[model samples]
Structures are given as C-alpha cells and as structure tokens.
Target: MKLRYWLAALPFIGIYSGGTLAASTTFLFGLPFLLVWNLIWMAATAAILAIIYCLDTRDEAAHAGAGKGVEK
Candidate 1:
C-alpha cells in the first residue's frame, strides 16, 4: 500500500481515542463532542480520498502519455 493509503487511515485512529473523550460533557461547535469528532473525521476521509483520486488521475495521465509512442 502507498503512504497515501496510510495517511487515509489516520482518521480512523481517532476512534480508539474517542473512549476517553466520551466522558466529557462538553459540546463542540454547538454539537455533541462525539458527533463533531465523527463529522471532522468524515470530512478528513473525503478530503484524503479526493487527494488520492487527483494524484492517481495525474499518474494515469502521465502513463497514458508515455504509452502513446508505442506502435504495437
């Protein structure tokens, strides 16, 4: 797996840490802390996926260009 894939897995790391946070009664941004945490991680996952998609698209384009000169 690529480093980017490991980076993408980072959002899930927050889940294990969430048990400690569940004891808190505080609200985040007017929402429940756990809700906010999940939302934040969800957004992060989307952003990471978008970045991976863009990089893969770029790599594919580069590969396709390099293959254009082949006669067979």
Candidate 2:
C-alpha cells in the first residue's frame, strides 16, 4: 500500500527469505533450531512493524493537522 509500509516490511521479508534459504542450504546444517529461530524473528519483526506503524500514523496525523491549520 504505502511506501512506508513497504519499506518497513522489506527487512522482515529479507530476513525470513534469507533464513529459509540458509536453512535449506548446507551452511547452517540445523533445521529445527533454525525454524524456531525464524519464528522468533518473525514475532519480533511483527512487533517492530506494529510500533513503526503506530509512530508513523501519529506523525502523519500531526502533519495533517498542521497543514489544516496553515490553510485557515
């Protein structure tokens, strides 16, 4: 949707895909542990994204209010 959302999501996607690829390859050699690690990463990523979204929305609303005030 928004560029901000896409930017925020890019890191998580990269981490998940990279982790999956690494786990699938012979570099890590651990499957179950890597899977669990990726799951934890996913959870952390979600939390970070939620926080970012909240902050961004707050900023955007403040900017919109400023613009409205300027128009008066």
Highest lDDT model number: 1
Which pairs of residues have clashing backbones in candidate 1? Answer: none
TM-score of each: 0.63, 0.42
Encode model 2's per-residue lDDT on 1-72: one tens digit a residue: 866677687666756666555545552335455565676677877877777777577777788788765643
lDDT of each: 0.77, 0.66
Cα miss at 59, model 2 (Å)?
6.7
What does candidate 1's lDDT look like per residue over 1-72, in tens digits?
886778767767866566588676689889888888788878877887888677666677889899899887
lDDT of 2: 0.66
